[model samples]
Target: MIKPYFLTALSGLFLTQACIADVNLESVTLDNNPRVLKSIALLQSLKSPQTAMQFNAPYVHDLKNRYKVRSLFVESQNLPIVDIQLTFNAGSARDEEVATGLHGIANMAAQLMDEGTEKYTANEIARAFERVGAQLSVKAYRDMFIVKLRVLSHPKKLEPALGMLMEILNHATFKKSSINLILSNTQVGQKQIQENPSRMMNVQFYRALYGKHPYAEPISGTQRSISKITPLQLKQFSNQFLVAQNMNIAITGQLSAKEALKLSERIAGNLKQGEKAQALPEPIDKSSFDIRHIASDSSQAHVMMGHLGTSRFDSDRLALEIANQMFGGSGFNSILMQELRVKRGYTYGAYSTFSFSQVPGTFSFSYSTRQDQLLSSVQVAHQALIDFVTQPIDLNQLAETKAGMLRAFPNNYSSNANINAQLGAMGFYHQAADYLSQYPKLLEKINAQDVQNAIQKHLHPERLTLIVVNDQLDKTALETRLKQDLNPQAAQPLPTENLPNILNPPEKEVIDLPVSFPTDAPEAI
Candidate 1:
């Protein structure tokens, strides 16, 4: 006998073929067409079996390096290309070490690294890479600075690309002209952030949550901070953080383990053996609800609520990952989406996410709605979080989430590039070498009770920090409404003294300092 799912699939395929054969969909009017509408309805009704997919684990090789540079390699002979990434602990978080107020020094240094080295002009550098069909890119995040190179596996192509990368790392000159260009672009971005509601809310949110910590500042830095960055500071930052001891290497594609080790050593030998960056201080957790209201002219309200969450090293990290997926991380199946978008039609989308980084990261839920519906949406989202934290997990949904994750797990390392990325992250975070192989078994062992316990231990609904960008009311009125709606059963009303004074933000104060310029400045445009 033909099974139900097979019959449904066969029917769907024949119907699809008939529609394609009979109709010119572009020419047909869709408004009142009976046959087309009937076909669409029939297609929507078709279902497929949710069977688990098995995938073989990719073999990962750990290459030994004597230069203190950790290395992970995976050999893929199918492609005639190589990908290399060097991840350093020199992100914006280390800016303060360069100077007290140099928030963007790391970002500035990264931008200037490849512009001009001691041996080549910026244009020469560009043409050299182009001649070899190679690509070099640099990016700085809150936790790490990454330099990536991609080139064909042929010796001629790989040799020149590797040489250019080393020259940039060891002898790049951070000229004054490049500094001025980045500063000008950052100033424009700061102005644009002020005018954008979502960006403004993000800036204020971090400030409120991490008062005096290093993470309080944005990676881009503020106008006041960026203006103070100098060429000397950029050089100091680069020298201190970009070192063999402070970074790791990830190599993938068309390379034997022996060759990969030699390549890793050559790359590591070019840099100074500088000390590792000191560990970052953890951001303090809030005790009470801290709310801020940014008055905007937008008819829709942008809201974000969260607090400091767990770190990458936490034992319950995997459980919290699953819990977050069930709560708001998944699109339509998430609890927040079902309550806010599907049931009430309050917003088009609602999402919750967790960031597990070097220190405790943030767990946040964000959504936007009409100004008049702001309070209702906030209440619904908050209540959903409360119930999720305080109640038992739904066992059926937990099973479904685990199954979906298992099926999708193979996609994480499906290609050489993707596998290299995973290896890089694993080495940086000090995970066991068998982490990838063990992830599925560990995840399967996480029961519903474990998920519920993890949620209860990590998530704090009562101590959330809230930020809203809306034009509906003044700060005082909005504060009152939030207190009433969120804590209706409190014998005494929720306190507003802890709220930030958002109405009168201080103006940027500037101080002038003498600056020096390189004698061989690039010619002005």
Candidate 2:
């Protein structure tokens, strides 16, 4: 659930049409005069890593009253820095389940919250942050929203930026003039995205996997849902959910614990009590398997296949993490890619990922290829899953995946923004406070059998939701093929045209053509 940041994090950033599947390091080319490695070596290696925890800042449980305020405070006399985060529970999923996607409208409203509070206009808010050399932001997530400030540890540098943030949160005037400009452009852009087959596949996949779960709903409202959302609705939603009960405050860098406590208190003190959130009920017991395909006129089929996956709370989450990497996630070296692309040439790249959410999220395998490859590709992917679960994962494979996972984990925390995201995830998912600190250790402890067990529990390919986006693929033939390969009976196909009746309003019917494959087709990874 980590989102990409320009500076800190990159998560599952699979394809770039502009970039090809070559190991060539174009960004670090030999043609340019590069830093002479020999010269740097002669300069001598770090006697010790220049960046290390000389002073391991012990996390304070701070055991403050839950209602009054809760915040993490850290001050390093060594560096004059401060990072503060305020996270609340009014994330995008708070939108009405049936109407869907009001969360996006809420996010846009939050961005424009400071358009013109009585004291400052939108431009003034920007100018103030520019003057202070600080970053101020409000971001929306699936389960929460965040307001943050990062600045040098000086009152002069902090107050104005924080002041603007307060106005944005507490008293926002969603100016009528700005409303049309923001909403109209947003709606148009979303419309374009929904039309794309791959995007549509992903959206519909969530609806299928979660099956009426709140988390299954789209973050951005549907076309009709957004049209009905007014600024008044934004105000009302914020009022109901952005209260102190759901708020968590954290500070890092050079801020005193006392100062951190005082600041956290001040920030949360005036917010009125937010409405209580309902705990989601247990997910429905999965029944006979279902194939939820979305046939489209696109040249290639966009497939989204998966079943309910482990939660962050699952004991075997770390094991599942390792298995995911070995099975489909290790990029070129993975078994899925090795069999499907390197050996057989099914798709350019084939991969799988296990999403760890507050509740069980989707464990999905996604790949796009010529429409005809649809059935065979799913069978191949499913066979790979079966082999992974039954076989004892080689210890070397587990070790390699663990090492890779640990190495990649720190890259995610390298940016302040990225760290805050991890913090938000940890807080919201009920993950222990030490989740990040302990990530390496936990991943290291995962033995091979742990992975096999996780697979057995979660990878019931029998109940998997196999979706393919091209109508030309012979569904009947594929189902017969899958039923033969795997003992699980393949799900019967539903008439694709019927989906829009309950999901999206019906659109113009489009015909799909039979897809042709090259004798030597370049894999679509």
Most TM-score-accurate candidate: 1
Candidate 2 pairs with clashing backbones = 75-255, 101-220, 101-221, 348-523, 348-524, 348-525, 349-525
Quote each prediction's TM-score.
0.83, 0.78
The candidate that achieves the highest lDDT relative to the unseen native structure: 1
Question: Which 10 successive residues of model 1 have the least lDDT summed?
Answer: 516-525
- Give all candidates' CA lDDT scores: 0.79, 0.63
The digit string of per-residue lDDT tens for model 2 on 59-80 reads 5334264465455443445557
Q: Which residue runs of candidate 1 sit more than 4 Å off their true CA positions?
A: 1-52, 472-525
- The local lDDT score (0 to 100) that residue 290 gets in candidate 1 is 86
Residue 176 lDDT in candidate 2: 71
